[model samples]
Target: MKARFTPALFAHAEAVLGQLLRFDHPADAVVSRYFREHRQLGHADRAFVAETVFAVLRRGRSIEARCAGQLSDRRRLLATLALVRGWSQRELAPVLKASEEEWLAAAKAMPEAELPPAVRCDLPEWLYARLEQQFGADETLALARAMNQSAPLDLRVNTLKADRETVLAKLAADDITAAPGALSPLAVRLRDKPALAKHPLFLDGAFEVQDEGSQLLGFLLEPKRGEMVVDFCAGAGGKTLLLGALMRNTGRLYAFDVSDKRLVNLKPRLARSGLSNVHPGRIEHERDQKIKRLAGKADRVLVDAPCSGLGTLRRNPDLKWRQNETSVTELTVKQASILEAAATLVRPGGRLVYATCSLLSAENDAIVGAFLDKHPEFTLLPASAVLARQGIACDGDVLRLLPHKHNTDGFFAAALERKA
Candidate 1:
């Protein structure tokens, strides 16, 4: 049901937007905190506030361009409603101040074609320039357009607990619409975002809320039933559960991370996943003794190295505003170090997959290229071939899933095998 907006709800949304514009914390965190503080908000009320605030964030640059000298959170919110949400000026008159009427009209009159290219794309100048150089101006704009929109909720079925068909049937019985995802055979794309925290199927761990693109990474590793596998940087054990299920819960799968809190968060999910093969461990750093002991013992290792997270703009638009070029450059250095450390775990003839949820080449292709140059013992495997073996059709030597092309979060993965 559509949330009924009142003057008070608008006040709540405006206050939340004001806080978010500070950009000191993640957008989700800020909104969640606000909701916690204001427990009086109904579910639909919270959803309305969050959706409105995120809409402004996604088109922040564009909305600011229109706001010009009169920039304020309220103005941005008004402009977003009028310009993006298709709210007629007549509909917005209930909350608009006398002075804002003319401003809203003029803001709507601002020609988008006349705005700067970066503003038009709703991206930062440096990010837009880098993307343009890599993908050309037209393609970058297309990518930005895709990223600026809301992302669909994609789920991965845990084969260890339930099959896709059964899960689909259950969702149908519950009146929750979903369909098979185009990319991963185990993927289920939901038609709408629903609160699944209390859903019996989700509580039972029949499936997980994983991006379809991320699910492909497990396919790249292809852990065998008795093989030892490691998910380096397994934040919250999303892929760890996937690898354990892929191995049919018969092999040892280690979930390692630097954050104890993230590993702690995985415990509940791990219990629901019905996987006995996963071992969660916290490490001080990439070169910690825990990782050192596992060197040359893993049959498959997945380094889903942390990056700038620019690829997740559709879900985390705040990141584009929070992350800058310097942060990305710093991340590249750390990514190289982590990839190097993780590669040491792969035994001779074992497979290693280096992946990132980053669109920048420096984090994806460049890191893999430099790794291959330094490590003569590891041969770059054609990602297309490996995915094809599992009935996935990928065209590139590396697996690159773009939001514009694949309707999944942007992802890049390269598969490598150690020479025996």
Candidate 2:
């Protein structure tokens, strides 16, 4: 249910947006901090504040274009309500001053077509240019429109504990509306985004909050029972748990990352997962001695490389504002280095899947193409054939999922097989 708008709720949203506009910290972190400090705010009020602030973040450029004069957080929020949220002038009068009414009316009357293409799509010019070059003008606009909206809550049923049908039934029993995801068989897409932290299904690890696009990566890797698999750069072990369950918890699945804090965060999830074969380890880097010890021994290695995270804009609208060409350039270098190191762990005749939640070609195809040129032993496997073998339908040399096309986060993955 939508929170009933009040003057205090509007004040709270404006305050949060002020901090978020600074963009010093992650948007979620800043909102979380605010919530922690203000324990008095109820769930509905907190939801309203977060949704309002995020709406501004997702359409800040468009909101700015519609407004005249000095644009403060209050004006941005007002414009958002008027233009984006479809708040009628009658609806907004309760919150508006007489001086602001005419200005807001003007903003509401402004044609979005008058703005530049990037502004109309609410994308940074540099990023919009790159996407336009990659996907053309029309496609990029559609993609941007999808990314600017909120993402649906997708859950991956942990096969080790429960099947998709069982979990769906349980959710239905609890009055939560969900349906099987169109892409991943194990995925269940919730109609409404509900807090599931304390849900019985979540606590017992019957399902995990994961994107359907992310679940596809595990099928690409296709780990078998009793095999040795490596999840290189496994942050908080989301995919790692998926890999372990796919292996029936019989194989040794190593979840390696540079951050000890992220590995620590994985502990509770791992426990809830009921998987016995997952080994969480902290590596100094991709070339750590620990990684070198297992060189050429892994049956499968998945490199879910870190990128600019532009593809997750639906949930993390702040990333587009926070990331720039310079940061993305640096990420490409690290991604290349990590992919190279992870490739060494895949045994001859084994598989390696390089994947990312990035929409940029610089971080997706370009990196893989360059890597293939350097490593002759590794041959690119058709992503469609791999997914098809697992009963998932896809059609391409690589798995490229766009939110507009797939109803999932934008993802790119390429499977490679090492010659025996």
Candidate 3:
């Protein structure tokens, strides 16, 4: 006999939750594998299971603590639906037992302060402490709140294919309503999530789903046509495509990454994008001889270094729980090494831009500061001036975006020019 309570879905959720609790693999990877294993789930069912499981992981600590040490997968799921998802007891009753109802009632009455700091903020303690150092009490609270919310899908119209107006018009023709992004000229903020994979415009490469904040990074690079540009950490070529577009497909854009897998993924995107200027290469590591060949040869280099990805909390809430102080410190070392290696690729008079998705000063300001101190040939250029030169007016010497301030992912960028 078929089990009660959406057996297939419940089983999927249970398996996913078990994997998530183990924390051995990325949540997305686990979810993807689950979907691949069970190909029968439709889009809506997949979304529901994925969202529900992520909700539990995002708020697992609080839920587990509320269970009074009697934590089981089923009880946690019921509590997650009730407390985190705000589902009514009657609504959850179908999936839960009468005994579970009493447990939930007791859990509902538990005081908030009794839970751990990680549970309180829905983040790991180490992450909470790190953020606490960067953000004051009120700001930390605000950031945590913002991170808990879902991110809207934003798309950047490939200018080479279509302008914002044309893209918007095309989308409207398909009965999709989109508004201009607050920050990026090429961006369109969709009112709701619409499947665009097979949309004629998307299939024709008119637009790509990218965060507005990320789109701004391409503008910050401001590559001129026919210039030699290098995206030193071009994982999957998200920014590489933008830089290629900015160069108007006339420049030699070298997209370098340490991971061959990421480089392979960029190939299809390159074809769909109609960009002819990009050259994707896999480096053995940052110090590869292939990288040395380009030393002082690039007119522009972007070190979009690997980071903690704290800025993307809205999209990956699980990160706040998975990240810790030790992991961040390790990342800082990698960032410094990558920046040092990438800086060598910039020619005298070239621009080297350092950027990260982290909001922490250690990863942002401190990394740049130490690099500037070690390299006298490189001097800081006002990012505002750089953007202004390109006719893009934004705030100050470094681009700092916050979820609360910019309604986008927290991003930090600084530009340095090699002394002529």
Candidate 4:
């Protein structure tokens, strides 16, 4: 049967929304299952349905509040389409009942002042409070506004395979537009999202899709050509690949993570990038025997700790609603423990880089501050100096990139060097 605007899309959307709202499944999983069950929807139809449903989820609280507790799944979807998606009643008349016009008018007139801060900012109260604590009134508003926008696609040229200029030229030749990134020499901002999986350059291992902010983390580590380095939380080896490329595939780059699934995912990327130096290790925990064996031996280590993911709102807006105070508190403890354990892998005089895709200072600065207080031998090194030495000029002691300020995911990175 053909799926159309009359009933099919709405039906699938309602089912998808029910699954998303009722259960704790990740948004991607929910969407994937929906697509798998209804494989008849084409790419354009799928995109519309998925994007509309996501917009609703991102602003569910606000939309529900506008409906004044009279919310049904259909009404909520209609409200979301009108308000967030800017669809007029006439535009939706084909799908909505004739009786819904009055309700849509009232929803359209819903005052911003009447809404709670969380609804206004499309964030949870706990998340807003934490950001308020970290950034105060003005900056938090700015950050929230930035997070509401879509994220751009970025690519990191694999120097071991090809230089940035060569890759850029090849990409241009293929009619894929990209420009040099603001900070990292290896980073390039693509004009539009393109599927590069089967592209000649990508297949040849000329580049990898990585955010510029993430690429900066590699620069902060400043791994030497032949020194042993470890990406302590190298999920899917995003930073691990960058570090491996930086080391010119000469040094051993240990990619450690608790997830065997994530390590397994990195294997193909390793082959694509031609990184012969990477060692993907699945650790039982932060204190796994494999990790302990490398204690005080690494020349550089990166702790891209698991975080609230507040900084990645553009890519994963659902996180703002999913994360709560209790969850953040649990993560902070884990982050601190991971940093402590990862620091041990760095030899005296070696560097440990701490990074997270979190806008909250509690996860970034506070975690590092607490770690510094406990470990006397490690001293904070200005991230600017570290990047400058690597020919990447960025300001501030800690490298902070907000979506609004840098047009990248909100990220914080701090470099620490151990004393001899």
True-structure lDDT of candidate 2: 0.94
**Candidate 3, residue 369: how far the Cα is off, in Å:** 0.8
lDDT of each: 0.93, 0.94, 0.85, 0.86
Candidate 3 at 98: error in angstroms? 1.1
| Clash pairs detected, candidate 1 | none
Deviation (Å) of 328 in candidate 1 = 0.9
The lDDT, on a scale of 0 to 1, for candidate 3 is 0.85
Per-residue lDDT, model 2, residue 410, is 93
RMSD of 3: 2.9
Per residue, candidate 3 scores C-alpha lDDT tens digits across 214-333 of 888888888999999999999998899899998999979999999999999999889999999899999999999989999989999999989989898787767776777788899999
For residues 141-245, write the lDDT of model 1, one tens digit per residue: 899999998999999999988999999999999999999999899999999888888999999999999999999999999899999999999999999999999
TM-score of 4: 0.93
Encode model 2's per-residue lDDT on 1-420: one tens digit a residue.
778788888999999999999999999999999999999898888988888899999998988888855698888998888888889878877688889998888888889989889999999999999999999999999999999898999999999999999999999999999999999989999998888999999999999999999999999999999999999989999899999999999979999999999999999999999999999999999999999999999999999999988889998999999999999999999999999999999999999999999999999999999999999999999999999998999999999999999989999999999999
Model 1 TM-score, 2 decimals: 0.98
Which is better, 2 or 4, measured by lDDT? 2
- Candidate 1 stretches with Cα past 4 Å from truth are none
Clashing pairs in 3: none
Arrange candidates, best lDDT first. Answer: 2, 1, 4, 3
